[model samples]
Target: MNQSFINTAVLLTAYDPPGPLNCVFFMLTFFLYVFTILANLILILVIYMDSSLHKPMYIFLLNLAVNGLIGCSAVCPNVMDNLLRDAQSISYGGCLLQVLFINVYASSAYAILAVMAYDRYVSICKPLQYHTIVTPSRVKLLLTVVYLIPVTLLSFQVYLTSQLPLCRFVINKLFCDNLSVVKLSCVKSALGDLYGVFIIASLVVLPFFLVLLSYIKILHVSLRASKESQKKALSTCAPHFIVFINFSVSILFSVVYNRHSTVSKYVNHLISAQFIFFPPLLHPLVYGIRTKEIRRSITKIIQRGILAGPL
Candidate 1:
């Protein structure tokens, strides 16, 4: 609808779209995406409205929820559409947009998670100085950088992929991704490949290392303190670790499954679907249940809703 639909030369032909039980799959995926988006949206709303959650940790959590909302929005509708149609394809611009949004989601997750770990470390290891260290201005600056850097990097990726003459247009997966687009390039781009690795290292590996270091420091300080301090630190960090482990493992599986030559199509499809689908759904559950403040906030909102009765 926006600027004529320029169909790409490549078509996305796989989604098991014409398979039997499409209705079942459609309903399942449709509701899942809806629930995922709703949960994250509500989390963002709660954090934004509640003055109690204006601190750096909650801001980072809000960033994560926003990422989930955008990421799920980027991939899920296409998936549900493909489930109902025999021909699954997207426009060239559409495909680039999808890949860019997904990569932005991925890159932002890393940056936000790193910032969160640093927040936790500051709170746990330097409690007296936490306010001085992680002030509101600092949080805003970090948040802006985390979001902006990813968008800029992924935009460059889209530019690189666009320069390539796509000799082939059929992407076999349920949705578009950067790697899939890169493979369609008429010429294998050594520079693009190198830059991609660099981006991955910058966004993924470095962030993971930083988070690890923060946790190490947190652990060191927490163990030396009283049982209450240790429990407090664990409670705060466990939800984040759960999210980190879940996403890292899911992405790892997706990467390996995609790159491997011998994976069954059905299995590859499932893993790929899970990669984009599950994180958004899981985040709210883990944090809403595990984090006491968020849990209490959700509970109060539910109580008020019940008290308000049918509107």
Candidate 2:
């Protein structure tokens, strides 16, 4: 690519159209984006509007839903637009914004999941102190930190990336991912790579262990409780665990796929989309199926909506 044109905009490909199925695949992508957004929105509003759900667990659930919404919005619309059109390009400024949103939301999710695990532990292990520990004000503070840490850390990442001079402008993937954007730089910054590893470890590894620790304590306490209590704890925490595993696998695939560029470009494209596309839909689905309270609330709301509609 011409060096002079690098500053103008970067051409991003959705997936190297591997076959003659571009129209059908893009259509599936568009509908999936729409469905994911709608399902997560429903989940969020159910948690918000239902006064019965105004507790610590549901509060964190709300945060998760919001993360789903913001994260999907960050990357999906751009992907959909690119897939529908003949050309796929994002301006330099817009690309930076995409990188910022994608990282911030993705990072915040780790924090929120950790918080949710802690919420579960307190509720199951220290029932008496659960209310005192996870108060509305405290939850507000936790969410503030969740979003704050990512934005602060990723801003530095973007700053380091911005400092690099780019002579290459083609991004091989669908959206402006942090690693992908950084990879385009003519000279790779050692400091940027170190910071990337640090923040990733901080965001992902630490939180996963924290969640694991909370669950361990929860399991111990749950075992000591009565059979009914054990079942109840399992019912509540199982869904969160499922979501955690689902998301962890997706993040792992993205990390592995990016690190190993020997993977086919079309294959990388599909794998990258899995992380951005699947979790939001999966979060609501897992919670809705596994959590008794959420299921009842959803049913009540849907029945009301249907009853209130025109005959």
Candidate 3:
């Protein structure tokens, strides 16, 4: 292979070569992509159309659905395109752009979950002051921080990555990630290493810690409250907890598997794809089924559609 081609386009050799199996994989993924998009879109539209859900909690849910859509869009189309092509590769610029959106999607996910945790904490622990603290302006500021932090931090990460000269062209994964791109650098970058550590600590560790703290406080308060209150709190926080745990565990597996992949290539691919597959598909479903208000809204909409059918 030519060095220019290697440098200009990184081959993703993680996937199986194009064949009947690959075609089947493509069809499965295509359906998943469609469902993921429709689910998130319906979640967003439901929240938007229902004035009753205009409150802070549902607003945060809407933000999450939008972020899921961004994350899903960043990877799915590219994956499908590559699956159909003989050479599964991505251009240098395109790889960086995918890295940017994916990193934003990931970092924004934890940040948004952290914000949601705090929202739950305030609502459960301080009901009287919930409206006062989580006011409309406050929610706007929080959402801004959710995207702003990820974009600023991950953009710097991608920029530093882009500056490195590549001595490697093939990525051993299904998609381009920052770590994979940085590993392709010909020389070691001390500054990039330090910044990478800083980003992991600030973006991943901190948000998880905040979520833990919020839940602890919520638990403490719930223990002291009546059974009815406890039930209410559990119902309210269950979906968020489920969503957070599922995503965090998937990401943890991906990181661990990438670092020490003793498993077969197919297993590694599936493990890595979990972060892309499960969260976007599951988040809206979890919230829609578990949350009474959203579930009720969706039911009403479906019923109305059924009743309004040609007669």
Candidate 4:
């Protein structure tokens, strides 16, 4: 550990909302944490237990649920802990660990979403070669790339950020993120800034572009196909698009709220809080409700439980 890091702590100023709002936030966080876990676990179990859902798309969705669990687990506990405390804060080491997992979760989401878009493109646009192209081994490779790239990059990013000596100990947000942590350093690092830009571009912007390209091609192919084929395309693509959009809007709005000084402090906290809260909950609900296969599997499991009980 660096000398600067010794006995260091960062105050989460935004966590200290006034009056009954604190209790409201606590109850809300607890509820979200419980439900998010159950929802994501159910999604994962449904996909794992059902052999029909063992396809590349469902596999990706399973990982997405797993990622949501990781993200919410990283965030919600810390948030709940802070909300309970009079002096809401996190130790430097704890904050960095939280930063790492949250970044990995967020970045891998975009990467996986991009890969899913490609999977859909292959399925719809190149149906004949879909199985050949998206083989099990290849799916594993894509997943490996999706997770490994962000973990490696964000690990390095966190390491670089850690080395910097922070002049300030207060982060005016619900939790510590890479940008929020980086901004506290007394000495600005040009390399860190540049690399941060590169990380955003590669993990975020590039995946977004890839998703757009894949969907554009899918749209082109769907337009020329029969009505039934178009409906099939819509059915499969709608859930993923909805998930991607929901996550994007939450994150984008959080960023906007953080950067805008005119926004109220509590309002900023509330908006930013959704970034951690919504995406995890939304993932399973959208997939479980929207995707027919997963929905059927969930229904079957529920019915079996009910039927297994004594009349």
- For candidate 3, give the lDDT of residue 191: 94
lDDT (tens digit, per residue) of candidate 3 on 1-311: 12343349889998777899889988988999999999999999999988999999899999999999999899999988888898999997889889999988988999999999999999999999998999999999999999988899888888888888888888988899988888887898999899999999999999999999999999999999999999999999999999999999999998888788888888888888779877999999999999999999998888888999975
User: Which is better, 3 or 4, measured by lDDT?
Assistant: 3
Encode model 4's per-residue lDDT on 1-311: one tens digit a residue: 35667468888888654457788988988998999999999999999988999999999999999999988999998888888788888888888899999999989999999999999999999999998999999999999999999999999999999889878899988899988888888989999999999999999999999999999999999999999999999999999999989988998998887787577777778787677788999889998889888878988989988999877
In candidate 2, how many Å is residue 85 off? 2.7
Superposed Cα deviation of residue 24, candidate 3 (Å) = 1.2
* Clashing pairs in model 2, backbone N/Cα/C closer than 3 A: none
Per-model CA lDDT versus the true structure:
0.84, 0.83, 0.91, 0.89
Weakest 10 consecutive residues, lDDT, candidate 4?
Answer: 1-10
Candidates 2 and 3: which is better by lDDT? Answer: 3
Kindly list the per-residue Cα lDDT of model 1 for residues 211-259, writing each as its tens digit: 9999989888887999998888899899999998888888888888877
TM-score of each: 0.94, 0.92, 0.96, 0.96
> Which pairs in model 3 have colliding backbones?
none
- Write out the backbone clash pairs for model 4: none
**Stretches of model 3 off by over 4 angstroms after superposition:** 1-7
Find the 10 residues in a row with the least total lDDT in model 3: 1-10
Native RMSD of candidate 4 (Å)? 1.5
lDDT of 2 at 176: 87
Candidate numbers sorted by lDDT from highest down: 3, 4, 1, 2
